[model samples]
Target: MTAAGMRARGNVRTLVLAGALVTVTAALGMVGCTLFQSEQVSKGQKLYAHYCMHCHGEHGQQNEGYNWGQMPDPRPKDLSNKGEMSTFKDEEIFGTISRDMKDTTPEVGDKIGDDEFAVPTMPTFKYTLSEEEIWSIVAYVRTLHGMKLTYNVEARKKELQDQLQTAQQKADQAKQALEAADKKAEDEAEKKGVEVDEAATAKEQEANVAAIKELEAGKTAFANFTARPKLAAVPRPDLTMAETEAAKLAETGKRLYGNKYGCNACHRVGEAGGLVGPALDRAGFRLNGTWVYRWIKYPQSMKPETRMPNLGISDQDAKAITMYLATLRAPKPEKPIEKAAH
Candidate 1:
């Protein structure tokens, strides 16, 4: 072969190899992006259900149960509105969702109040979620609005960690300042030949303690939020009932108690339940079936300001639940010991 021909063939081979490498890299990049997006959207859907759907509606239509009566005045924004969502940038949506009342610059000597209201106008997820998680929610929101936005999962995670660290630093500084102020107040009272207001001092100390506790709780909650621990499956409660017509109904009530009614979420029956409501350790001894039935059916009729929501319990379900509850009786008290007369 001629030298010129050999050189030409070598040049063509080099170009072909480079082209293949480029193609493979581009394909791999595309695959990675697709996978990342899919995972984020899935996370976003779960987060939305857990957080946003209560106010925004299931499908973002603002037609949910809460939107009608439970939500505050100037009801939650209609996220389903394509035109309205179109105006805001992705960052703007994120800011709106995560911004808290205390994000503003505090005046000199003003403490950052960490206590969130029982029911906020628009609750901030900054305390609950990291930046990555919030962006995942944003990505999901985009899907609802019929748009595809790119999300960088790793970069957002780093940003979120940095933000959390900054918040911790601020909390630490606030706590230290409060401690110093409390000590200074005590010292000043001692130096001054005046009576110290014990009540006011005690109240101030209580506030400082609460602030410290809240900060610690916030850190623990955020850690748990990031961990995303798997929830344990609930075991069926073994309920005992007397041999009566109501007892027959209690069987169905037992299932309803554990599953649909979500009574177990608040009321503790045994080892497994929340502490939101009074434990039914011996509810039967305290009240009769008739009263229990009325309370279950129309709780508001009895106490207007009850924390328990009117679940619109059907007559049969309420009766069944009442029967089941009536079976619960407190243990008999033991006799007290007599003291010897001196």
Candidate 2:
């Protein structure tokens, strides 16, 4: 063979090998991508196996109370019906697992804003896993079946969007209607020659000013005057962590909570108080101390229209309060928060 022919043959052999190698690498890369995204059911199941399976049951059929945590049902929610759960959109189920429904507000049913979980035992998982991991868990949970749901989320969102549009249109119409009515009223007033009696108006104004002054006088807690709450003391609103007490801060807390703050006016310690607030013997166990502290520091912050007046507690005072309450840990576990009155 000629020298050129030999070199050409070698070059073709090298090109063929390189092409085969490239094809092999591409095939492996595609396989790797597929595994990474592979609907991830197993990865999800494994994640659930690590975090949820113990209480939720191996197959989600376990019905047992918590060992350390106190729960009314003790048993975790069962999530085994495809037909039933099919009603929930991926978003809601994702919510249940990821959002820690217990951390949710009790009045509204499962709000993170509430003390993290209405069910005292459930821990909030907000910090533990990523969103993708949570979604994968939701997909795995979908495999479980039985409870019925009313509406899938996509449908609900659409329904809500439609309702919002309708409401906006109605609001616009009502505003226009109100403007027309107000214009008519003004026109009628002008025609009627509306007039005021100055002497009578002056008397009415004086009466209103006197009444406001009386109200103001009633609210002021003057030194040495022992201002009485016009309304009888109310049941304290659910307090925040700032509202509670812990061990270390108990000494100063005893003084402030008892005397200056007048907490004992409603709350009781050892037989030296009133029945307005819940007994504080085991306050720490009753509600999470953290929540109590929050309640104390800013009770009204939790429920804007709450009966409890803002006590104007400072942050330092709140910390001391939590420290004292921690000293009030229950000798034993409290009975599961009574199906907490809705």
Candidate 3:
């Protein structure tokens, strides 16, 4: 009950508090690391079946029925080649799934346009799946080969850069051809001794020069126009494999077509992505969910004559995708085109 007794009690309480803090820290760490390996493996299976299995077969050996094998000379690689699967790290595989060869959104002409916009080349699923889902796919891939394959991303990047250079070269050739044609026309005008409007001709020459310069700019974007446009995105947490999961899958599937899976890459759902394929703005007016699921799973199998490539989706992914496609209703009547100002 004196000063020394009070000081001794305070010291004991400090030690108790420190011990509890240490205990809590260790528990939190264990939870963070627990079963991480298996979780990653499960995620990989989902990604593989959804994105790789069609060509790789059920077990990832390899097959030809899927579009990957349907080439004039199908060369689907054997993923079991520990060397091949090991070639990519988790991050690299995720990068590949994010974009297509050219990173261009596919487009086909519209009913309203004199012609349709070009659809993106490869379907972009970047928006459909989360960063975690995508990253998990990479982690799962790492488990395959056992021998950790370091993805030579620098080399792949260089290859992409080379493709870009090749595209630029083609554009340069096109500009040269345009200039040659323009020169020929100007020469003809001079031949006729027509009093040329020097000012207008100068203006045209400058405009041509500017346009040729703009071709160097890789892709055009309307970033300034669509800032924070409230696009619908699929919320997770309800994705557990449960009864309500089916309804949630349908909601997620529809979101993918609109904002995630990049189905809008080719198929325009009226107000959705560019016209790379037939407008599905009203797919419901034409087909059913069974057909959509079957097509999403194996498009070429059903329509061997069609050019629509397989998305390499899994049963669950297909379900989610089909659910969204089912939402496609016929487009409203086309609006009247506005005339240009005189």
Candidate 4:
């Protein structure tokens, strides 16, 4: 071949090589993105199972094996329903998950029986989970409705910073209000030529100081917050057991019921716990193990308006708690001596 022809061929080869490199790089980048998304979804699934599955169900439908018809007016929504879930934006869902949905005060006419207000049963997760964890959960929830995960970390961080600023401003305003109130009280007392109630003033001051401390602590927590991606380990409860295995499981349940889950907060076993719920001292005699297990797993399924929130108890944990509760039976009655003599 001529020298000019050979040069042209070499040029073509160079262009082809550059094209291949670009294609390969693009493919690798796509793969990396897919892997990252998969990891995020996996982390979310673990979190959902641990914290949300009890009420939201395994697939975001309501929990199984209960008469949902008997549930309260606004039962847990069908999260897996695409038509419903699609209407919600990612940020809106994230907000709902992070904040409490209950309405503390309702319109006077809207109030239900006895001073009770009908409100959503969903609880706040902001205290229990970090911002990143909540975003991950949002991503996972989207998957249930066949939606893609779309998260903007930088935008979210900016939003959080703005919120912190607003909170700081509110705290300053509250302090100013408290100070003004104190000064006004002192001036009025002086003008009236009467001494202010020292004890009442001291108590009010102490409460205000405590409130300020709490606000400061909350601000500190917000300022120092950072998102770190990590997968949580999901607990698997043991369910297969024989009658002989009851004692061992019961012991485990005792610890979980009394300490881990803080069941005693609302339930009374003997002389302890609050009066918010019924006493459980004779639960063994009154309740069945299977019934107890289901109740602990998801209480809303049985009684939609029950104050008990699902603690995401695993099957094993529920079983163990059931065994422990079963041990709280009343003592067997004694037979009469006259019947034995006859």
Candidate 5:
């Protein structure tokens, strides 16, 4: 073969090798992205189980007993409903999760001070979770409506930038308004030959200052924004116990009912407890053991209108509580009191 031909063949081989390397790199990058997203979803699942599953259910739908009579928006949102979930954007969901709808700025309207909905049932989580943790929850919630788990870092950055820009604009406009008000007031005072009241726009001045501070904070948040890393998975509670372990389980249940879970706050074990719920001293006689277990584990599932909030009780704890309650058999009434004579 000619020397030039041999050199040409070598060049073709080099190009093929380069293309293969590029393909392999692209594939690895895709795999890494997939793994990261999976981890985020896994973390989100753990969070949802711990914080949301009781109200939202094991799935995003409400628990089995769907009847929540008389309460406004009667039942918790059916998050698994694709059509309903489709109406909300990811950011809107994040905001809803983080803020109390009634008190959050811009979202408030005629409903803000309504007597009927004065206290929102959904609690605000802004104080409890970091921004990344909230975002992770949002990612997991998307899956309920059949969306993929994704964290669009660039998109979120743009949102932060837009928010910062809006805040800055509001701050500027407030400053200008305050300055204009002051100038007008000064001019009027000068024309009238009276002293200007420096405190005339005191409230407006305070509002302007607040707006400026908000703008500065927004800027800082935007500057520091970055993609959240995957969180460590939360451990699941152990629910395993042998059938013969009744005595020990009941002892644990006694501690949980009185101390750990605060069951006594609403229930009465004897003359010593609250009157909000029926006395449980005769729970063993009045209620079935199996029924007690189910009720404790998922209160809403049995009676949607019940005020008892599911405390995310584990199966083991529920069983223990049931056993403990079973031990509370009040001595049989000596004799049923005769009905009062009419």
Candidate 6:
């Protein structure tokens, strides 16, 4: 064979081999991504089963206690319904699942505002799951409706940091302005030969210090958005037990109310408690059992601005307490003796 002919054949073979290697590498890369996504979705499924299945249902299509189409307003969404799920963006779904439903008063804003809805349909998962875990759930949710989702943690973290920085800057600016006002007031008091209200000044200083501390703490704590919740889960009581067991449950509930739950510290029950909270002496008659039960379990869920802390009362304990409270109806007023004269 000629030298040129041999050279041309060698070059063609080299080009073909190179092309084959490129194809194999690309295919392997795609397979690796698919495997990683499958793993993420699998982890998310487990989490959903544990945390979401109670209200969202076994397959995200049914609610536990209510009839599907006949339930009252603000019912759980059927997550397995493709037509309904398709309407939401991935970020929207993630935000709905993880973020607080109500708009808390921003540190920089003057006017108070709240969400337009009466009550949130779902509880916030922010206190429960890490950012990565929430993204996993989002991926799993896609599978429920036969879809796919990919999340960028770094990008979202950057966005959150940017927002926090802006709010912090505003807060710092407000603090400086407050300090300047305080200094000006002090100077005026000295110039006018008038005594400053030392108590008010001290209170103002304390408030300013608290605001600074909150800002500093927020930057460090919320940087990673993971939280260790103060309350622990307690077992729920069975409300449908036999009537013969009522006295035992009430006695246990009374003990919890006075000591373990510490209700008497803030609320009065037949004059044995403080005035920090309203008297619970007749709360059973004044309030409905269902409302009381929910309030004891999750106070801020019904009233967002409430100072009540979730004390992590067990479900069974709450039901027991409810039963005890229900027995405290006020005595009826006596009829007048004038009826005998009539």
Q: Rank the candidates by lDDT, best first.
A: 5, 4, 6, 1, 3, 2
Better of 1 and 5 by TM-score: 5
Tens-digit per-residue lDDT, 1-342, candidate 3: 999999999999999999999999999866754555457568767876665554444555655324333322223456557877665555555666554322122352122323222222234344344444555555555655454324433354455556557656766766675566667667877999875445445644665566556444432112111111122222222223565766677676665454334465445555444332566666767777676776665665665434355444556667787665655676565762222121
Name the 10 consecutive residues with the lowest summed lDDT in model 6: 333-342
Instruction: Write the residue-wise lDDT of candidate 5 on 128-246 in tens digits.
Output: 45566677788888898898644574467688989999999999999998999899889999999999987888877998999999999897676444432222222333445666687
Writing each residue's lDDT as its tens digit, candidate 2 over 224-276 gives 02221222223333333443333445777665565345555445565445333
What's the lDDT for residue 26 in model 5? 100
Question: Runs in model 2 with CA error above 4 Å?
Answer: 1-39, 64-70, 100-122, 145-325, 328-342
**Cα lDDT of all candidates, in order?**
0.62, 0.52, 0.52, 0.65, 0.66, 0.64
TM-score of each: 0.43, 0.33, 0.32, 0.45, 0.44, 0.45
Candidate 4 TM-score over all chains jointly:
0.45
- Per-residue lDDT tens digits for candidate 6, residues 1-342, read 999999999999999999999999999989987887888789888887765654466677864422223222355678989999998888878877665434222452123335322223344555546666778889998998999986665466676677667667756776786677678778888998997655545655665677677577666555435432433333343466567687677776776565445555446565355333566677667887777787888775666445455555567778878877876775533531111110
Error of 5 at 238 (Å): 44
- As a whole number from 0 to 100, the lDDT of residue 225 in candidate 2 is 22
> Which 10 residues in a row give candidate 1 its minimum summed lDDT?
101-110
Candidate whose lDDT is highest: 5
Backbone steric clashes in candidate 1, count: 0
Query: Against the correct fold, how does model 5 do in TM-score?
Result: 0.44
lDDT of 3: 0.52
RMSD of each: 18.4, 19.6, 21.7, 16.4, 17.1, 16.4
Per-residue accuracy of model 1 over 191-305 as CA lDDT, tens digit each: 9966655654565566667666766666654564465322232223333445777678877677666544556544656544434457776777887766677677656556654
